[model samples]
Target: MSSAVISISNQKGGTGKTTLTMNLAAGLARRGRTLVVDADPQGSALQWAGLSSDEKPFPVSVIAVADNLGREVGRFAEDYQYVLIDCPPTLETEVTRAAMRIADTVLIPTLPSPVDLWASLRLANAIEEVKLRNPRLAAYILVNQLEPRSALSQGMKQALEEFDIPALNSHLRRRAIYRNAALEGLSVYCMGKRGEPAAAEIDAIIEEVL
Candidate 1:
């Protein structure tokens, strides 16, 4: 079967891009075989996966590709049902551009800050450019680390409407469990009750986006 390539990308750092990529892959693995492409030069996804014990390793496989990202992802796509690419933090890099070009859906993870929303405009423009070549590419904004009661969080979707790319209806709240899971090299799904809510957030996102 052909894999659904989803790129977790953003122009700015601190957007929890890699964190979302790992957890999203965990959720997707429940449905079928999943793979994560660690396209970020920082190799954060590799570190996260490395933290897992053999007894309870991170579900699915993760590989790092230094160059020819699209070609590498395409080769692996034939082997998995889902491939999530954890792109480099900056939009200026070819790694980010390559991921967008090959992605069936580009999930641009962003914060609720005004600065992040503005930065997304740059990525939005980049998406349009990629679309010129990849006409079927679809994109969305994923508002992360949300505070449900905060003014900015409540108005996130409305704020995203200003950009060409739409925001996902489901969002992830600021939960210690996400970081906690990271410390242990596990997805929220592997954390038992502590991870349930966060896992639900991931499930909601995958459900809505897919």
Candidate 2:
């Protein structure tokens, strides 16, 4: 089968989009060939790949093209089992739209906050617009950096119930391990004991999505 293209997108920055993209890519790489396509001009995912160890499992490609990215990425998808695109945090960008045009699934990572929730709705609206071209496109909201004990987390779930897009049952907690692992150009899976939970969460997401 051709690789499934999954786009990690959010209209708001700092929503853990790049973090989710890299970790999810690493998680999926364990089972099969995986490639990450960094569509954001920021090139954060590309920089992460550079910082990664020489033994890193997967390869990342940078594709900043705003037009015809769907066609460009379709060619890359031929060799890998899975392809993930880290999109810029803005729906106004053609790169984001192009990624959505080809993606089988769009994962929107958002913090558990009122602002992030509102932004997710806007992103869902944009995805709906993109669905016009790619009717098979599926989008899911992933609550990231969640503090389970906080009231905000509980409230965020309740608020999401009102939104059109469904939120994933699994969530990623706020943890320093994610940051530490990123700095070392590693995924949570390589963090040993400290990363076990975080790694499991990423694994669950991969399972649920794929």
Clashes of each: 0, 0
Candidate 2: lDDT of 51?
A: 84
Instruction: Compare the candidates by TM-score and give the number of the best one.
Output: 1
TM-score of each: 0.97, 0.94
lDDT of 1 by residue, 84-201 (tens): 9998888767988898899899998899877788877888888999999998898989989999898888677677777778888888899999999999889999999989999999
* Model 2 lowest lDDT segment of ten: 57-66
Task: Give the per-residue Cα lDDT of candidate 1 at 1.
Answer: 79
Q: Which portions of model 2 show Cα errors greater than 4 Å?
A: 55-67
